[model samples]
Target: MNEFTLTADFGMTASDNGFIQYGIHPGDTIMFKKAEDFPVNGSIVAVIIDDGPITLKRISFYGDSLDCYLEGGSSRVAPIFISHAEYGRLKVLGVAVSVIHSLAPAEE
Candidate 1:
């Protein structure tokens, strides 16, 4: 797939155990595409949960059910399993094709 980039326009800060953590600083570029538009194994994606907010995770399948496995980056633990009924409630926002972190210099 061709590579592309997106700039992050917002930032979020959360705390755990009285320690503050930051994620996705504004102006950071991220490369991504629609997950449903390109369903591939081992792809990281943003998915809608219960018609609620969007979340990011790796995609997997459990029998006829769709599953999402959370990688240990933050304090969040455990894998999430959703039945076809529950899966229907989820909307695949986008697949993370690549990441252009703030630490990295911009490419020409």
Candidate 2:
């Protein structure tokens, strides 16, 4: 099985960044496998669009937009909006089956 880690922050590191990536925080880890097929609604998927960084989110297909909910995210975290017109750029890399929160103390 192949695995992917956040070897590079890509300058997007933040508290909510981790929440959107998995659950806990940055430095935390998760295990996933290829999505194989387009994920259905409510499925946690690792996806990317328009050559952007990969992300983990629960997918929901809307009429002209793709609503993606971040797993274990706070109410303040906004859902990522992707227009159907950009669907061609959507790439589902894998399904996150498990998460491992970083045990290190979080900094304020």
Please report the candidate that would top lDDT against the real structure.
2
Model 2, span 2-107: residue lDDT tens = 9876432122223455365335466556566676676777776767866888765677666544544334344564676666555677787776666666677556
TM-score of 2: 0.57
Residue pairs in clash, model 1? none
Writing each residue's lDDT as its tens digit, candidate 1 over 8-108 gives 43322211211112233333444566544635656656667678865555666655434544332345556666655565766777766444445653343
In model 1, which range of ten residues has the least summed lDDT?
Answer: 11-20
Worst 10 residues of 2 by lDDT: 6-15
RMSD of each: 7.8, 7.0
